[model samples]
Target: MRIATTAEDHRIAVLAALAIAIHVLETALPSPIPGIKPGLANVITVLVLLQFGWHTAAWVTALRILAGSLVIGSFLSPTFLLSAAGAGLSLAMLGLAWRLRLGLTAIGLSIVAALSHMLGQFLLAWWLFIPHPALFKLLPVLLTFAMIFGVLSGTIAAMIHRRLTIGTHQT
Candidate 1:
């Protein structure tokens, strides 16, 4: 493991900012599948996890969710709660995957993380917003897309990380 220096911290901050910007863009985009998103932001989270550590990645995830909510004016709503839950669960999964040395490809890790995130969000919604169990029926469809998009985003992130590492010494 590498100790993060001032330079690394600055780099992480820039990455986080880019992640947040991507989150905002995703939030603004219209999706044919309701509540389904490309989750482009996770690309940064995975990069953060790989480059820094799960702790820093967790912080980034939380900050992204909180700041994103405020920026979108959904801070006080149920949506915010859902987002927070999803972020927390996904961070936990990402950390566990790292610690266990899952050896999963980036796409696999992203799929696992995204699935956990969606499960967390849907569970929260079912518990707090929906009065019936039928709400869960919609999850399969949502999860399918989440898996696909997660892989796509993760692959893109992995590629970017690879490209960024070229000719650059690792910290």
Candidate 2:
């Protein structure tokens, strides 16, 4: 028996591949703190959310996390758990933002997603791995990085989105 696939599936696969490549490359970079990377892969997620709506964005993100984890050999590890938590929360936040019709642009949504992703990971780490009050002390610093990277990725996403939108119209 064969299964059928839609163009949407191909689109998701391509986007997920791009995101996974970015995710893997990011793992190679050095971070000042353990989990303080720029999360540049999420630039793709934000772009997907802006262009394709929440469902497609969710598919792309879920595939990215699962496949990225597998490729990075972090599947079912603590790192994977943290990533899953962060991504799940981030996607949920984006869904809510979309449903609310908040009229937020890519930058606004990216900032929101980044902050929520950090919070989710921090909370999971505190509750599951560390379970220490001292962990809360790092929240502010982590959130600061999240904010900075959020803007950076958001700006990149916005530029790409604009370019794609313009290209679509030109043809």
Give the top-scoring candidate (lDDT): 2
Superposed on all Cα atoms, model 1 deviates from the true structure by an RMSD in Å of 4.2
lDDT of 2 at 84: 95
lDDT of each: 0.83, 0.93
TM-scores for all predictions: 0.89, 0.98
Per-residue lDDT of model 1, residues 1-171, tens digit only: 987578656765777788789998888899887688888898888777777778888878887888888888899798899988888888888888889998876677788778889988988888888859788789889889888888898898789778767736655
Q: Which pairs clash in model 1?
A: none
Candidate 2 per-residue lDDT, tens place, 1-171, comes to 999999999999999999999999999999888889899988999899888989988998899899999999999999999999999999999999999999998889999989999999999999999999988999999999999999999999999999999999999
Highest-TM-score candidate: 2
